[model samples]
Target: MFLFIRSLLKSPLAVGALVPSSPQLSRLIASQVCCGNSHVLEVGAGTGSITEALLNLGLPANRLFVIERDPSLVAHLYKRFPNIQVRCGDAEHAAAILCEEGISEVQTLISSLPISNLNGDNRIAILEGMMNALAVDGQLIQFTYTANCPFPAKRLGLHAERVGRVWMNIPPAVVWKFTRASYAL
Candidate 1:
């Protein structure tokens, strides 16, 4: 908790919150993932909060991969979730990270990163990498505290729907489940 707070204080834009995501929000995000063939990839997995929720929801640890940019948080995640893999890298470079980790595609990509705070290029790159890594029927689960789409789907020719909302969080949050352009709502 102290580590997360310190990171958040040091870099508000990067950390995006005064505290880690609420477990309820984490569980809500995890519940959106359905059983599938391809593996699951989680981005910005700070302190493994969302990872733990996914694991508790019966996701196979071996089939789950997490990427956290901060080396310190990555180290904490590694120590916390020893059975799971945690790669220290940027979400914009997800494709390369996955390829380096022997993952061609994923059935789901759940993200804890704050897209609203990232710059246009970084946001586009992250979304592009996610789209490239997901399967045909895959989903991208992203949560934001804002009322509307933080990463507007219309800009990317994609579609997003509110799958769940957690008012119990520090400032409340909404989980928007995004799908491919052709399959969007």
Candidate 2:
């Protein structure tokens, strides 16, 4: 909690939310990933709440990769989840990070990134990178506090669906799933 507050105070825009994700929201986000041997990537994992939920859902530590921009949070994640691969970097470079980690593609890409706070270019870059790192039929699961879609799904040639909403969270959260428009149709 202290780490989260320190990080939030250091950069409100980067941290985005005032409070860490609630367990309900975390489980809802983690539930999006289907059970299998497929690799999973989680971006902007703040304090690893959702990561814990993912692990609890049967995702192996070796197959779960996490990318957090905040060095402190990255360190926390590393110490908390010793078996998982935790990297400190920007989500816009997720594809490169995954490639450097020897991951060709992931079956599920879960993002806790604050897309609504990013500029147009950064949003596009991050979204494109995430899509590129995903398998052809892979799904991208994202949660936002707003009712609207966090990103321009159709403009990005992706199909979006509002999968779930967890009102028990701090400020509440809505989970959305995205996939290549063609594959989705």
Candidate 3:
């Protein structure tokens, strides 16, 4: 109710529509998945704003795994989208999910967690887990209000590029696209 509306207003990019409008289902669907055959791993699927977008973007519901830490949010996800495998846990435990799913690699990873809100160690751990779960050609899309790349985008031995910006967003935010740097043969 109030929380859902607050979330919608907080992240304008996550939910494309302004108030009293249908959810911005398109923006959420826009992600880093390549070739349309990607296993998407989304972190901080708050209120399923991005989750709904992911589904609308044609990312197969079965192949998409959402990790939400808040129990209330997880309940919301389950109620809204019963088909999705919404797990109630921390994103830092991402590796466990990978192992449980027998997912050797992910094609794309999208994170909306307030990386700025995490402690240094927890932030590092979560990013490292995502790196561990990604394939060689996998891509990661993350958004932040900061002017710089969040966390160790490159410090983790991963190459990062600021692909685009969404000024229409409430606080205005930038989108970073990360990938493994190419090694010459």
Which of the predicted structures, 1 or 3, would earn the higher lDDT when compared with the native? 1
- The weakest ten consecutive residues by lDDT in model 1 span 150-159
Query: Of the candidates shown, which would achieve the greatest lDDT relative to the real structure?
Result: 2
- State the lDDT of candidate 3 residue by residue for 1-185, as single tens digits: 56556655676444333332124322733654563565788877777767787777777788888887766667888898888788887777776786787766677888776776667897788787777777777777777767888867545667888877766665566778778777201
What does the lDDT read for residue 25 in candidate 2?
96
Best by TM-score: 2
What range of 10 consecutive residues in model 2 has the weakest lDDT sum? Answer: 30-39
lDDT of each: 0.86, 0.91, 0.69
Candidate 3, residue 91: how far the Cα is off, in Å: 1.0
Query: RMSD to the native, candidate 3?
Result: 4.7
Q: Give each model a TM-score.
A: 0.94, 0.97, 0.80
**Which sections of candidate 2 miss by over 4 Å?**
none
Tens digit per residue, CA lDDT, model 2, 39-67: 89999998989999999988889999999
